[model samples]
Structures are given as structure tokens and as C-alpha cells.
Target: MKGFMLMFMGIGHLYEAFAGVHILQYMYGCSRDDETEQTERFGQLGYNGENFLEYDMKTLTWKSRKQQAHFMQDEWNSDISRLDFWKNYFSQTCIDCLKKQVDKGKSTLMKTVPPSVSLLQKTPFSPVTCHATGFYPRGVTVFWQKDGQDPHEDVENGETLPNDDGTFQKSTHLTVTPEEWKNNKYQCVVQVTGIKEVFIKVLTESEIQTNWEDPAPNIILIIGGVVALLLVVVGVVVGVVIWKKKSKKGFVPASTSDTDSDNSGKGVQKT
Candidate 1:
């Protein structure tokens, strides 16, 4: 990023030397990864160029650089001449200068790393934030969209912030109602030049967290049933058995009946 700023400064200085008017152009801009990009330019004519002007790419408006106010210019011819000069300078001279710098081993092409994207809803009333970080080239776009269209209201946009690792970061938030949240029409879209495809995330139940109970009780019940059955089988196979005896009560003998019959025969003979 420092190298990039210096290069622009060098271009402005070289143009001033060539034009002999001390033309000063201060360009400032930033991007998140490569998705969304913006640039601001404030140019001057001489040392006391406090009345300088600038162009804002996002709003498509021109304003005074020092005062940060918009004004109409009646000097169309003068503006046109300066515009033409800059066009030629960037087209031919800028390219040649950059080539020379590369030949002299003063320019480099750094590899860009893709950003990490996250969609978060902190609270019920709070907005859903789409955050991206750790990207290169400082050019990226993060937006809240519905059905492929940009929402006009209930949206908050954040500035592109720098990270410690030299990558860029940005975030955007959308305040949605419960019906809109579950409608499946809301999505967060991200785009970066280094990445092949756009990154998109949606709000769903699968993204939320929930609590569940432990299964220890079910496991204990299963073990107890098995042990009880084993104890029953062992008792039937190895246990001792006891029997009770019955006593003799009454009996009839054959000698008693023969004696009674002999007594009856002796009584008849005496008669």
C-alpha cells in the first residue's frame, strides 16, 4: 500500500515538471479485497490551489477539495484542456515510466490473498453484518442485497479498514424483520478480483446454535437388563432341591378275617 501511494505521488510530480504549471493531484481510495472499489481525486493548479476541485467516483459528483462543497464551473474550456492533458499523460508517459521502473528492478507484483467472509446476526433487533478480512489488492465489495437488488433503507455501510497483516477489511449491515429474515430472499454478496467466484452467504437455522441433553441415562438402563437375566439363569442350574416324606396311617390284614369266619362255624355246630 505504501508503494502504491508513492507511485501516484511520483506521477503527479513528473506531470507538474512537464506541464510547467505545478499541477498537483492527490488521489486517495481503498477497497475490500477486490469486490467493491472507490477512488477520490483532488487536483490543484499551483501552490495556492486552495480553490482546487475533486471528483468522487461512488457518488458521481465533483466538489471543491479544500471546502468539501460542490460548485458549478463556468470555465468549461479550461477544464477540458486540463482533462485532455491528463489523459495523454496517463496513456503514454505513465506507461513508459512504469516500464522503466520495472526494468530498473524498482516495481514488483505482489500475490493477493482472498478474504474470509462471515454473516452474523448478533441479536434479534440488531442488523445482520457481512464482514470480510485478510484480503489483498485492497479492492473488495460487501453489500446487503435482496432478489438481486440493493436495498434503499435500513442499511448501514462501513469504511474500508486496514488490518495488521497488510490486508484490507470492510463490513455492511442490514436491518431485517422476522418475515424478511426467513423469506430466503436476503443474502450477503462479496466480490474480489483475485477470487474466481463471488462469495455469498444466507441466514438459516443451520447457522444457529442449540443445546442438547446427555445420553448417560439410556446407556445405564441397557446395562442393568443384561446383568439381571444372567443372575436368573445361574440360580436355576446350581441350586439344591428338598423333598418331604408321608407317614403310614391305617392297614387291613388277611389273618384277622379268617379268624372271624372260624368263630361263626363253631357256633353253628354247637346249636
Candidate 2:
């Protein structure tokens, strides 16, 4: 079935090149009922973003969406060997492959994955967001509880969203003053389908994670760094000045004494 789909796509591309069509789209898939063991197959062809042809598996014929596509439809339907291949593939080959894939991934498809819950807040005054992510099966309930009971007011629930890893995430927001939550015992609860464990996060100042940072500490660090750098610069300058003074004091007197002795010897020669 997969091979046939690939071959059909290759043919479509070739047709697009010769027919001067900008785009050609081919969609084909199958669905099955687990209990009834019944399967249904469907296929469609699009030309330049418009429906051009459809396949009717029951009648074993192609249906033209537009009058201009009738010739192409007839041409495809007249190929007996292609029609036979489709009939056999849709009925047997596709079902067999689907069942094999399902069996190969049975553990992943049937197993339940638990979510990681977190309490997030942008600021102290903003609403507290209870985030639960990386759970499987998509059915999850997230809410806030106050003093061991569900809170009806000041709560907002968000829709479940899918992650790139095939897991799901959900969030619930609780809007309350800091004093209100601090005074009451507030908690976020996550209940995932097919799992017996209930995840809970108690609301507290320490537990609520925030992106906000205190500027006072950073400012103090900056000031300390500047003072340290200035001290280093001053120490370098002082060391250089002291070395120059020592060099001048040690060498200047000796050179002056030698010059005076040379002048006295010249005076003696003149006498």
C-alpha cells in the first residue's frame, strides 16, 4: 500500500511537469474499527488547490470533481490493472500493514504517561498559572483546590495542547491576592486519564516560580565589580611610580660621584 502511494505521487509529479500545473496533491488513507474489524479506504487528487478527482472504492471507479477533469478520470478508470491493484491493496494490503504497525507500537499506544506539574507566575501580582505537561492520552483535568475543596471562583482553565513529542499539556490559572492564598491552603491538582496517581502542588511563596528578578542584588554586584577594578588600576599605578623613584635614587648619586672624580683628575693634569 505504501509503495503504491509513492508510485502514485511520482506519477502525479510527472503529470504536473508536463501538464503545466503548478501543484498536484494526492491524499490517501484508511481507517479501521477495532471492534468490528471493518475498514474504509479513501483517496483524493487535487490540482492547483482545487479538487480534481476522487476514488470510489465501493464502485471501483474515479469521480471527476470538475468538468475539465472528466477526461483524466476516464483515462485513469480505463486502466484495468491499476483498478485491480487498488482494489486488492485497499482491501487486504492496507489492512495488513495497518495491523502490523498497530501491533508493533502496541506498548506505546496502550501505556499511560504521567505529567510533570508546575506552578508558574510572571509576577507576584499576576495570576498563578498551574502548568502540567508531558502526559499521554490527552485526557487530563487540572484545577485549583482551596482548603481541601475545589474553588469555584477566581479560576480559569485552559485547553489541552499537544507537544512535539506526542504528549499533552494543560494549564489552569488561579487569580487571588497573595494574602488570600497565603491565608488559605491552596493547591493545584492534576488528574490524568488511565493513571491512578493524583499529582498535587501546594501553593506557597517558595513553590510559585517567577521570571522576575530582584534588581538590588545585580546593582550591588555591579558596584562591587567597579570598585574592585578601580582598586586594581590604582595599585598598578602606584607600583609603577614607586619603581621609577627607586631606580632614580639608586643610580643618579653614583653616576654624579663618577663625573666629579673625572673633573678633579683633569684639574690635576692642568696644574
Candidate 3:
């Protein structure tokens, strides 16, 4: 199934409580057997949510179709609209685009790489995540299991979302208590179409690493060490400068009269 809409809005034009030019909408659907379905081609001319033209591939006819040319009110007029012509045009265009996309897809092989599974315990609850990425043909199933049995009622299944690298990823979360952490067994299981085997892993605390663990303490320690070294160097320099200044101004004790008398007595006795 495919759909396309092209709207042309004149300046200051308003429709459906919005200002815009609504024009040229197209949609198409195709399958392995084209005969099995109807309403394959549908389009709307205005923004009023009314079907402009719809074609049934089974009956190959147009029913209750309306057409609106540029800046014109919608009216049911198939005589001048030529529904068959537009139907063939949209069908051909869609089929050609589909073929091109299919060819491009065929060039790349479809494969499934098992997800990297991890278990996390965050205070009140524990969550197990299975990141299955870089796989083609996006259909995948990821779920959780308790002990050796199927998923329990308490399990929460997350939606399968696309990744930036054109692959798909999904996570299944299960809440656990502290008691459950020590006593219960939990695992995350992954299954994809291309791979025949199912991937399974038991949840473990060792497998989970918190990305938010702070490095501020280590950084502060490094800064403190640097500051302490600078302080020690400054203290040593200041002490050495003061000691040198005191040594330059030497302390000489005053010579007293007693020393002179002793010297004179010794000289006179020798004479």
C-alpha cells in the first residue's frame, strides 16, 4: 500500500480551519495477486476529508467520485474528470516506484543479527533490554520470560522502533523487586524472520552498566592533587627565600670588658 498527497494553497486561502491550497492527492495498493482486492486507488482533492476519486481493482469502476480542479469546489462529475485515465496513471506510477524500490531492496541481503541483551536494576524496578539492530526485513519479535516459562502478566512490551542505520530495535521491560532480584530467574528472548534460531539470554547484573555513572569525583581528585603540588612548591620557595635573607644579616654577639681584661692579664704575666 502506498499514498501521496500534493496540496497547492493560494496566499491567504483557508480550508478545514487552516490556510492552504489543497490539491492533487493520490494513493495506491498492490499485492501478489492484484485481483484479490478493491479500493486500490484512492485520492482526495481538498483538505475536507472527502474522498475525491476511488477505483476498485476488482470491479474496475469508479463510484461516488468527486473531482476538484485548482481553486474549484468539489463536485461529483466523472464525465469531464476522466477517472479511468487518472486511475491508470496512479496505478502505473505506483507500480513503477514499487519495482524500483524492490530492485534496490533485492541488492541487499536480508539477515538477522541477534540483539545485545542486558539487565538493569534501578532501585524500585529492574528492566531487561534487547537491542537488536543492523538487521534487514524489519519484522522482529522481542519479549521477556520469567524463570523457564513464557512471559508473565507483569511484563511490559515496548514498541518495535526503527534505528538511524535502517535496522530495527525493540526492548522488553520487566519490573523486579530486591527480593525478586536475588530469587527469580529472568531472560530476554528475540526472534526474527530470516534467522532460524531464536536468541535467548539470562539477565544478570554483571551484564548491565549504567551509562550515567559520574566521573566528577575522579576529575576533582586530579585537580586537588595539582593544587596541592603547587601549594607545596610555593611554601618551599618562600621558606628558602626567608632563610637566605636571615643568613645574610648575620648575628654577632657584643664583645664585653671581661674578655679584654683576660687578654691583658695573660700578656702582662708573660712579660
Candidate 4:
């Protein structure tokens, strides 16, 4: 059976430069238990954070919380029109609004979605992270089991986080060495709320997604590439130095008369 609580609150504040601040707070709500079919309605008023009055549904009267507030209770209770309005609003109008809201959001409130699980490791020696994402209802359990038994040691659980799409995600980490996991059977288990099927992933080298890669295979190639690049760079620098030196040695300053144009309208040309 599904149970729900619906509440409505109204607050008003009057501020005066000399008078400071006066606040009026009204809170009314209804809650229902689906299994018992029990419903309860409540309403209260507060002033300056202190309880001022409470509504008695049976007596249809405002109960004063403070001795000083009795005058207000008397004034409000004598107003038959206001009393009638509240009686109808709480009994009918509030219930109607709650029903409409529940009906409108029934699909989202009732829906359950399963999560996609993954095993991630940042490095070979780092902890194996069990990640579950894109699940709905936000209630899920993620854990690691070793040799078909749950291990409390070296296990860390993370808080559930909400996704932008209204779904949820959670993660758990299992810290174990390669030799330990290799000898024992390790698995990641994910159980989402409202779903009966349990999701499990066996811990294996092939199953782990990691950014770490064995550099032994490419070490020689990488070193050779780096050496070749350094050689090319050095050769280029040497060539540039030689070219600059030769240019400086070959460079000659032009004389003023050689740069001057002849009277024949023919510009002086370099030979």
C-alpha cells in the first residue's frame, strides 16, 4: 500500500521601520495511510514563531495557544462566515487539490527504473569502483561480495546523487589487491528499489574499465619516438644556426652612391 502526505502553508509578514516586524504563519495539511485508510487533517497558526491558535475540526473553533491570544480566538470564532469558510476549505477544497496533484503526478510517482552498473578502476592498484547510474526512485544498494560472502572490510559506500533527468546514481568501492581478487570470486551487486531482479557483475580483468594501461609493451617504441623527435629538433636547430651564421658572413652594407638612381631615369641595379 502507498501512503502520501500533502501540506499547504501560507505566511504573511508586515514590516514597519519603527515597529520592527510582525509575522503571521498558517499551516494546514492532511495525511493518509493507504493500508489503514486512515486520514488526518490539521491546521495551526503562529505569530512571531510562537503558536497562536490551533483549529479544532470537531468543535469547529479556534483553540488559543496563549492567554494573550484568547481575544483573537474569541473574535475569529464569533465570525460565523469566516468559520464556515475554513470548515469548507479544509474539508473539501484542500482534499480536492491533493487528489488532483496526486492524480497528475501518478505516473512519475509510481514508475520505477533500473540502473546500469559498471566496474571502474582508475589504476591497477586503486580501488575497484562499482558505479550505478540512471536509476529512478533514488533508493538503491550497491555493494561488493567476495567468495559469495559480503565483506565489511575495505568497502566504502557513496551517497546517492541526482541526475539532471530526475534519475539517480550511486557508487561503492572495493579495495583489494590483484592477487586477492584473482584467487577469490568477487562480484558487484546492485539492488534497486521496486525491482525484484538483482544485478550482479563478476570482477575480472576483462570486466574492469580502467584508464591505466601497461606501458611495458610500448616502452621501447615510445623511447625510440622520443629520441627520434629530439634528434630532429636538434638537427633543425643546428641547421638554423648554420644558416644564420652564413647569412651574417655574406651580408654586405650597400653604399649611398650605389643606392642612388642615375640621371638617365634608370634605377641603380645590384650586379
Ranking by lDDT: 4, 2, 1, 3
Q: Worst 10-residue stretch by lDDT in candidate 4?
A: 256-265
Model 3 misplacement above 4 A:
1-26, 33-59, 63-101, 108-114, 121-130, 150-156, 211-255, 267-271
TM-score of each: 0.44, 0.57, 0.52, 0.70
Q: Which candidate ranks first by TM-score, i.e. highest?
A: 4
lDDT of 2 by residue, 84-141 (tens): 8878877788777877777787777667999999999998889999999999879899
Best candidate per lDDT, number? 4
Residue-level lDDT of model 4, residues 1-271, one tens digit each, is 1776789899999698998989999998887666886777888999989999999989978999999789999999999999998898778887777778778998887789999999999998999999999998888999999999999999999999999999999999999999999999999999988788999999999999998888886998899999999999999999999999898877588656743645544765868
CA deviation > 4 Å runs, candidate 2:
1-21, 120-124, 137-170, 179-271
**Candidate 1, 140: how far from true, in Å?**
1.5
Misplaced by over 4 Å in model 1 are 1-45, 50-97, 100-110, 194-196, 208-271
Instruction: List lDDT for all candidates, in order.
Output: 0.59, 0.85, 0.59, 0.89
What TM-score number comes out for model 1? Answer: 0.44
Error of 2 at 120 (Å): 4.3
Segments of candidate 4 deviating more than 4 angstroms: 16-19, 144-156, 183-187, 223-271
Question: How many collisions between residues are there in candidate 3?
Answer: 2
Model 2 TM-score relative to the real fold: 0.57
What's the lDDT for residue 88 in model 2?
Answer: 84
The clash count for each model shown is: 10, 0, 2, 0
TM-score of 3: 0.52
lDDT of 4: 0.89
Query: Candidate 4 at residue 206, lDDT?
Result: 94
